[model samples]
Target chain A: MQDKKQLITIKGTREGLTLFIDELCSFNEAIKELHDKIIKNKPKKDDPIVSVRIKLGNRYLEDDQDKQLTEIINQANGFKIDSIESEVIRKEDALKWKEDSKIKAINRIVRSGQVLEVKGDLLLIGDVNPGGKVVSTGNIYIMGNLYGIAHAGVDGDRNACIVASYMKPTQLRIADYISRAPDYESDGVYMECGLVDEGQDKIIIDRLQVLSNKRKELSRFERRVQNG
Target chain B: MGEAIVITSGKGGVGKTTTSANIGTALALMEKKVCLIDTDIGLRNLDVVMGLENRIIYDIVDVIEERCKLKQALIKDKRFDYLTLLPAAQTSDKTAVTTDGMKKIISELKQEYDYIIIDCPAGIEQGFQNAIAGADRAIVVTTPEKSSVRDADRIIGLIEKEDMKEPPRLIINRIRNHMMKSGDMIDIDDIVQLLSIDLIGVVIDDEEVIKASNKGEPVALHPNTKSSIAYRNIARRILGETVPLQSLEDEKGMFQKVKKFFGIRA
Candidate 1:
């Protein structure tokens, strides 16, 4: 049994510690070995809780095998043994996190009647066609041309901004306020649009105009009153 | 193996019935044994569009409930040798046909026919579920208008939830080229971009479609009509033929040109 312990290996991952059960031993014996190893490696009472993942051979555990494993896990101390069914759990969790962190898109063109709604910041790798919409809770970033409606700061985050390679949106909304494109043809330039103030009370469209005039106006008024 | 295709649009009046009728007819014309099931139940119009409403003595409900045989309920198309219509019961509501009934009927039909085309009713209700219950693929129909496209988008999302092997293709119907060109209407690119689906067909807005529907004749039967041509082209594409999409802009003739000159837009 002491030499049998050398066959099994344990390593830690993002989710929990992975224990590789050796194929040489019967599934029941492997479960016993795993339980004993876990008991010996149990962390001190002051240490943080550690989770464990049991990895059986290529063949999936039978119903009877799972029952035996569960009994072993219950008997073990200071550690919880979880079965790693597939690699999908980790990948899906990562994908969910990626989706929540930012809105990433590789669309060639966003056509009319299409509404693309993202929870976080939106990053589109293509053009937003007329009548299409991109709504996000955070900042909106378009790698290509934007010719449709884009609403940033959907959850009322005033610091949110809309950036595009060619910023020619039909209508843009940041926080609460919205601004429509000028009627006449304007100089085609890559631009960023956002609200400069903390509360996002004003809408400003600028081609590299870092300090919004609206913000300057408020500050200038405050300075004059203070001097007086 | 026979394939089941569901034709659905979440919004009403976006040409789901019309597309179903035309596509089924076109498939039949191609000599594929096709059965078109109208899953709209109480509000069925596939029978009317296919010119078999008067002939529907026994409906899908009667067949599923074992009140009548499946053969007794199936109405064969007079014009097409390979096509049949399973009309929905006008007297009974959508609940009359359950998803299990639809799955069993479609499975039974799959053994006999090359294609089973379900004419899904508008809305993502029990009727829609019944229609898509055994569908192998789906074709979503939408118009250029905002409401129709929005509904189509919703339907597409629902179809995705079904976890079908293939994504549903999009059919943008009733596109008025003159209106689109004048910037008065939503363009095809915009619809495609928003839906993010492969284009199956684009049906132009034609007065002849209404005329054909009124006469209980599908527009696909009228080969000379532009809408008919569009339907036939869609059918050919469904048959896996590499056919170029017919340009809706090409139908803008002298009258449409005159309308444009007069600044009149639809």
Candidate 2:
């Protein structure tokens, strides 16, 4: 019977030593364990191979966090990093890895000169101030005001729409069509949605509730398939 | 330690150079040794603004490339014993001044001058980054215009991420008391609220400022007009003196001027 390791799993491959941190333990604890283990294995005064590789399985490492981990390994026992294998485990075309399921949600105000781009659906819970921009390949949903520029359906998805609490934007683009806000737009704050008008093949703006009703029907179709 | 301050306005023609020259001259007048550096290389205007264009035998590029000693590149202000102007390179571009080079130059100047005011060029490009490289503090200058205020907002956001010792202060330059009164221009409170920073000073629009610039004299040299008072107050505030915003604080005088101009009998 083999006892399960708590912190990390070390495997000696033909290339070099590979260290895998346990997912259950905290990152700080794993880092400390890795440091102690490297120092403990610091072969006497001379070691031929004094480097190891760290493979982070299915974990996103921010720049600073990666820097910290590398610094920890470098400063201890003269062991340098051979390679950092950031295995994100992305499964292309798998059942669970649907491209349409990807959604980017941001909850802060986008100020001037700020650019927010997303590949799939995007949901913004804050305002997009003037000089800001939001670009997406799929639908865009803004819970707050849209005072900046927004472009949806960038990759020829005409069905994609942009919904915002206030639709006074510098410019709006859907699929191949583009629309600019009229100079004399009403000053009232109202929820609105922008989408392509199939009949005219032009982008148009209307109340957000109209688009929400359409979304409700689409979700209803999805729910019927799931129930069956 | 001496503070290396950069006076930056993201938009052009918003009075950053004017603020730098005034602040430097004011600090020097207070008996503090000051060095005014113009980092707007290739498009140098600080010397012309200070009326010291004829004294620039050596520019910032000369000192950085080791062609001349630091002191040789500095043009001393004839009016003040403690003030000097380090002119920018007129022919060389902003790339000539590297951030690391600026850090070294600023550190060397720190040993001599009590305050180093860098006149940053407009735009958040190489010039902006180079000027801010060694700054311990920042002074963001802006006007009441929408474009100016928007750029100022962006600059403040950049300044926040700059990891400086302290956040930058705001100076609303060229404020017309009349425009503000008639609601044609943004108010001080609105500008402050939008920029979201400490309001250090508010300078009123004075015709004398243009006259002073032509003569290579900073407005702070004189103590008469509202422009002069505003610049002097800014200097006092920079020297750790708590000065109120004279333009907004004394609304009685401005109100009377507005009323007199419009011929309102009340």
Q: Provide interface RMSD per model, one decimal.
A: 5.4, 1.6
Candidate 1: tens digits of C-alpha lDDT, residues A12-129: 8997788776766776667766777767876777776667786666545666877777776656555675655432234565665555454466565565556788876778888776
What is each model's TM-score for chain A?
A: 0.46, 0.52
Per-residue C-alpha lDDT of model 1 across residues B147-228, encoded as one tens digit per residue: 8886787677678779687999999999998899997788899788767899999999999999999889888887798888
Clashes of 2: 2
TM-score of each: 0.63, 0.68
lDDT of 2 by residue, B1-266 (tens): 68899999899999999899998888888899999999999999899988889888999999999999998999988787799899999998999899999999999999998999999999999999999999999999999998998898788778877889888999999898779999899999978865667999999888889999988899889888788888888999999999777945334587788997899974
Query: Which structure among the candidates has the greatest DockQ?
Result: 2
Please write out the lDDT profile of model 2 over residues A27-104, one tens digit for every residue: 888888877887777666565656788878767676797899998777765566898876564365333434554668
What's the CA error at residue B152 for candidate 2, in Å?
3.9
- Those runs of model 1 whose alpha carbons end farther than 4 Å from true positions after fitting are A1-138, A142-157, A164-191, A196-200, A208-228, B249-266
- Tell me how many residue pairs clash in candidate 1: 6
Two-chain DockQ for each candidate model = 0.05, 0.28
Q: Which ten residues in a row have the lowest lDDT in candidate 1 chain B?
A: B243-252
